[model samples]
Target: MRDATAEKTETALDAASLVTDMAKRARAAARVLASLNAEARTAALRAGAAAIRAAAPAILAANAIDMERGRSLGLTHALLDRLMLNEARIEGIAAGVEAVAGIADPVNTVAAEWERPNGLRIQQVRVPIGVIGIVYESRPNVTADAGALCVRSGNAVILRGGSEALNSSRAIHAAFVAGLASAGVPADAVQLVPVADRAAVGAMLTAQGLIDVIVPRGGKSLVARVQSDARVPVLAHLDGNNHVYVDGGADPEKALTIVRNAKLRRTGVCGAAETVLVDEAAKDQLAPLARMLLDAGCEVRGDAATQGVDPRVKPAAEADWDTEYLEPIVAMKLVHGVSDAIAHIERHGSHHTDAIVTEDAAAAEAFLSGVDSAIVALNASTQFADGGEFGFGAEIGIATGRLHARGPVGAEQLTTMKYLVRGTGQIRP
Candidate 1:
């Protein structure tokens, strides 16, 4: 028994060493990636898109295995939805890659240039952020999206997807590797940790010097663990308790449509609305909206005022206000006005995404300015918070943190700026 325990310890050490080595290779490859011309990087992404399309059959098969396992594990329907991938979804992922390839390369772009009085010229130019470690959950599409976004921005990435999607992520990552090779970029530039062990996640979190930044993409638990345990800087949001507010001036028709799409279009996505705040002045509209959601099969949990408006609404518990349902469930509340709505969101929101459905310019401006969130919308569905919807091709993830990056983190957000100074033999004295 002692020998067996020692063997297990040795295996754990081997895995840690392997992960460290992977980070080292990624750092080296990052330099190569950053030096590559924009055209070369774009070619790699385009090639990756093609490769993914070609491998759709294999990817789907791998997804099937994961789906079967998820079902047996009694994973929630929302999670199952995130885990399942069909041919159409594969095609969508490929299209996202292609879109990213078409975006303007951020590397070497001069953000600002200034000339000093003493004959020195200073330029702030964008550069890759070096190695980015993405630790994500069951969504295999994130593997392709994160890899493409990093390559597009000239940053090497190390992907650590959820264990449940290991087979699917591996299959998708193979396409990224093939594309990188075809474009003459180092395959190590975009690598997925082949092991699914939980210990590997710990190794990634502690790789401070090796990984320049860690981006965690998933539910609150995953992001919380990464944020709390990671020795490296993490770009992530702890929760996406997103909210949609219907103002007194909101058009009844538009509010109903936006509410339906925001909450029910795809509840599994992080941008999906979990809470609905209705202005007390517009309380009359609540019954119709609640009925619409219920008719569409969404379960509505509401405060007393909202429940009074609609008999179908279930009484909401206190915790519902702070919850990210990520399912076909929504919490509804009646706010005194725009100010109360803003206060409610600021108190319970995850600062991820929030929306205001109003035609009143003053109310819209107030809500937009008052709400402290990464992405705030006016007269639009909160689902528009996506990086793709923001026209960046694809996103690594939505960062609610106020550090280097925020909102939909695409290729541009994956870069950092450095000052480049040029002087012709100027002496300090």
Candidate 2:
């Protein structure tokens, strides 16, 4: 019999070595990608989309194995949904890749140019971020989206997906590699970790020079861990503790439609509203909304005012205010008005996405300006907080940070700027 301790140690070493090799390959690939022409990058994306479409059957088959294992492990229904894949979803993934191909290339393009009085010409040009490491959970679609965006933006990527979706991610990654080959791009430009060991994630997080930036997309716990532990710089996709506020001046019909849709529309999405706040002046709107939620098979947790309006509502815990249910459960509360609603959101929101439904322009403006979340909406479902919805094709993730990237992170957001100076031998005396 093999020594279990020795076997585990060997496996750990293997995972670490795999990550190191992948990172080095990715760094070399990134240099090639950064020097490649934009048109070639777009071609690779288009080819990848076609490859994804062609390999749908194999991908779906691999997903079935993941689904079986996921069920055996008793994963939550929401997580299972995120892990599940069908032909339609495969088609969507392919279409998303193609959509990314349709976007204008940002790399090497001059965003700003000026001539100084010193006879020096300066230009700020967009460039690839080089190598990116993405550690995501559950959603296998991220494997395709993140890889495509990186390739489109002329960067190389190394992905470490959740163990539960390893098979699915591997299948998708194979398709991407095929596309890269077809387009004459470096095959290593889009690589995924072949192993399911958690150690791979650690290797990636600490890969500072090898990885230009790290993007984490998953539950708050996962992101918090990556943010706290990673030695490399990070682009965090924090919790989707989103909110929807119905102002006193909101149109009742619009409020009902947007609010219901925001929460009920594929509750697993990061944009789903976790909390709903109604202005006390519009207190009459609360009961109808609560009744609609209850009728739609959604659980409602409410504060005192909310409970008074609807006896069916369960008493809300204080923690519910900051929760990201990611299910058909929502918290309801009543605020004095827009200010009060804003205050509640500022205190409890995850700075991801927030929406306000109102016919009053002033109230809408106030909510829009006051709320500091990445994506803010007026009279629309928070579900619109998507990269594809933002017309950027597919997103790697929604970046909630206030730095180089925010909102839906697409190809343009993946690039950093560089300065090019042209001078006629004028020395700075």
Q: Cα lDDT of model 1 overall?
A: 0.92
- Lowest summed-lDDT stretch of 10 residues in model 1? 7-16
Query: CA lDDT, every prediction?
Result: 0.92, 0.92
* lDDT string, candidate 1, 180-296, tens digits: 789889999999998888778888898879999999999888888998999999999887899999999999999999999999999999999999999989989989888999999
Measured by TM-score, the strongest candidate is: 1
Q: Model 2, range 230-277, lDDT digits (tens) per residue?
A: 999999877999999999898999899998999998999899999999
- Residue pairs clashing in model 1 are none
Best by lDDT: 1
Give the backbone clash total of model 2: 0
